[model samples]
Target: MSTVISHRLSLLEDTNDQLKQQLESLFEIGERNEQRFVWLKELVLELLITENTNQLDRTLYSKLSELENIDDVLLFIFVTKPKVKLKHIRDTSLSEVPSRLVSLSKTICEVCRANEYRSIFNVSIDSSGSFALIPYQFKDIQGVLAIGSSEPARFAGRVDTLFLDFLGEVVARVVSRIS
Candidate 1:
């Protein structure tokens, strides 16, 4: 009886160990997926900044679809002081654009629930979050890129702004060429 009990204990221990190993493997996979997404985003931004084409909108839309796997994206260019509108581009319905822009504040806007666009755009991400890239020099309002994912946590409020800012700079150059 003693021997049998010992054997059972050993088997239980082995099962626990296996379960732990499996959990660790799953965590590693999640980390790798996140890394891949970030890397792809970086690569696409680099390409956008370097590309010398008047078709900035087309190129950007294509890259956004391929890289980040976002559900929706909207690009708007407006002047700050006089609030003049230069251009607007959307991946979806035109009627939805205004409600989306309404959430944006006078300054750089971040993700928030009040933003109706954020809710709709977030449907595609495995992690859910919305972000906007607004240039520091708001005089001309150079450009703005709004991205949202279905994944609730993908574009957390804490994400670094460097990438989006870089994107804004690139868009500014593209606008310069076209304007």
Candidate 2:
């Protein structure tokens, strides 16, 4: 009877260990999510305060540069009714951009696919491993935000893009206000 009790106790201990590991994993995930939330909030605050295109451009460059995986960023705004002229921002015709980008309202990130990506920025990123094409629109302001990474898996298909969407939304809000 003691042997059976010992076996049962061992099973219970194993289950307890598994539950503990799960809890630890959950806690770690929560901490990471919290950090990301804080970072997004700070970025939104900074972007909201931008009063001009130059300031907006600088804010985006500075904030994105802080990330190790992000090696480059470019913004292209579609020529609108009033035509925004910003020395720091690139203005392009809607017809010039790839349709995939024009149609997308969300960010599409993946390992380098030369054919589609080559013309988006009007610059060659043959060496980049991955890139994100984030599309945004706010009334008169519509544009694509491009970010590249040297790490192939950094912006892979598995990466969560809710953060990217938020970034795009903030950019749209800033552009709408400043333009």
Where does model 1 exceed 4 Å of error? 1-54, 79-111, 118-129, 136-141
C-alpha RMSD for every candidate: 7.8, 2.6
Clashing pairs in 1: 124-150, 125-149, 125-150, 125-151, 126-151, 127-151, 127-152, 128-151, 128-152, 128-153
**Model 2 bad stretches (over 4 Å):** 80-88, 114-118, 121-128
lDDT of 2 by residue, 49-168 (tens): 889878877888788877777776778788744354443367677786577667876789898865444655455555647888889999988988888776788889998888898899
Name the best candidate (by lDDT).
2
* lDDT over C-alpha atoms for residue 122 of model 2: 51
CA lDDT, every prediction?
Answer: 0.54, 0.79
- lDDT by residue for model 1 (1-179), tens: 99999999999999999999999999999997798679766655655565433255556666676645365555655433333232234322334345545454333434545344445343333332455545422333344566655444446666666666666666666555444
